[model samples]
Structure formats: structure tokens, C-alpha cells
Target: MKPKDIVLDFYKSDVLLDKKTVSELLHPEVTIDWNSSEGFIQMDYEDMMSLTDQMARAYIRSKIRISHILQEDNLVSLRFSHFVKTIENPREDMLLGNFFVIWEIKDEKLFKGFQMSHFS
Candidate 1:
């Protein structure tokens, strides 16, 4: 699948809470670098799911809207805004950011991924 399509699918799966689809799209050894004020947080597939599940439980709803998408070779850069409503807060919060994800595909499956995000 095209990089854009892959990204779209990932978002769709997230919206639907489809773990299977999310797992399919992600590499088993995927490295997620969450850029934060504290430091760069890295996670592998299992840790990612653990963190995701915790966040999912805390948030009532979350969605990502892509403003721009760029692809070159195996790299895909996505600029997007995310809207999230926490169950406790019950108020929507918006975060704008750009993410760069480098994907390695093998046999039509994503074998590895490295990602970093910058907030605006």
C-alpha cells in the first residue's frame, strides 16, 4: 500500500479501536520516539500497545486530522491536528503537530518503523 494509504488506515483503525488493524500496520520492532519536554521517549511494539491501552482508557474519544502528507521513498511525513477528550476532563483538547515516520516494508508488510513528532 502507498504510504498515505497506510497512514490513513492507521488513523481509521485508531478511531475504530481496531487493535488487529493497528497491529498489522505496525512493525513488531517499531521504534516510536515521542518528543516531549522531558525527553525523547522510545517504545517498542509491546510497550506501545501498553501505553496506548492506558491512554485509550483515559480518553473518551480521539481523532487525528491530517493537514499535509509527504512521501519520498520509504519515508512519510504527516502534519496533523489531534482532538482528544478525556473521560475525566470531558473537554476536548486540540494539539497540532507534525510527525515523521520512516517505514521499512518487506513482502507488502511493514517490517520496521521509526517515528518522531514535533508539536506546534
Candidate 2:
């Protein structure tokens, strides 16, 4: 897949809760630097897998709605919002945040990322 397509598929996937998908899309040495409303966080592949497990326990389902996407070579940038249905209230989807992220695809997987987000 093209870099843009890989990143798009990653976001369109159930990445928050599915470890198998995450493993498939993320490189073994993947690393992400994220700035969110909560604070800054740096995560590696294992951290990402752990986060997926945690989200699985906390949310019933989740989705990403992309507003914009741009690609330059192996770099793909996207703007989107995340919505989730909590385990406690599975019937309603709550807006989790709005995000802007740039991903670098290497070895046909998400190798590196820089992301920023704020609460919606």
C-alpha cells in the first residue's frame, strides 16, 4: 500500500481495541510522540499495544472520522476526530478528541509519528 493508504487504513481500523490490527499496521520499532489535552506522551510499539488493551477494557467501540489527509513521500498527515462508546454506556458515542497527526511509514508499517490533539 502507499504510505497514505497505510496510514488511512490504520486510522480507519479498530486500532484502539484490536491488538492484532495494531501489530499488523505498526512496525516492531514504532514510536510515537503525542501532545494531547492531558499532556505529552511518548510511546513505543509495546506501549501502543498496552494502550489498545486498556482501551478495549474501557470502551465498547471506537471510530475515527478524518477531516483531512495529505501525503508527501513516505510521510502522511491527517486531521481527525475520535468517538467512542464507553463500556459503561455502550449505546452512545462520545467525542473523545480532535487530532492532527503525521506518520512516517517504513517497511510498509507505521514507523514513527508525531501527534497533537485537544478535547472536542
Using all chains and alpha carbons, the TM-scores for the candidates as numbered come to 0.73, 0.95
Lowest-sum lDDT 10-residue window in model 2: 8-17
**Overall local distance difference test of candidate 2:** 0.92
Give each model's whole-structure lDDT: 0.64, 0.92
Residue-wise C-alpha lDDT for candidate 1, range 1-120, written one tens digit per residue: 776567666765245244566678777767665665446787778876776677677677767877777777666666666666767767756553555555555444455666666665
Which pairs of residues clash in candidate 2, taking residues 3 or more apart in a chain or in different chains? none
Clashes of each: 0, 0
lDDT of 2 at 102: 96
Kindly report which residue stretches of model 2 are placed more than 4 angstroms away from their true locations once superposed.
none
lDDT per residue (tens digit) for residues 1-120 in model 2: 899989987887467688898899999999999999899999999999999999888998889999999999999999999999997898998998999999999999999999999997
Residue 29, candidate 2: C-alpha displacement in angstroms: 0.9
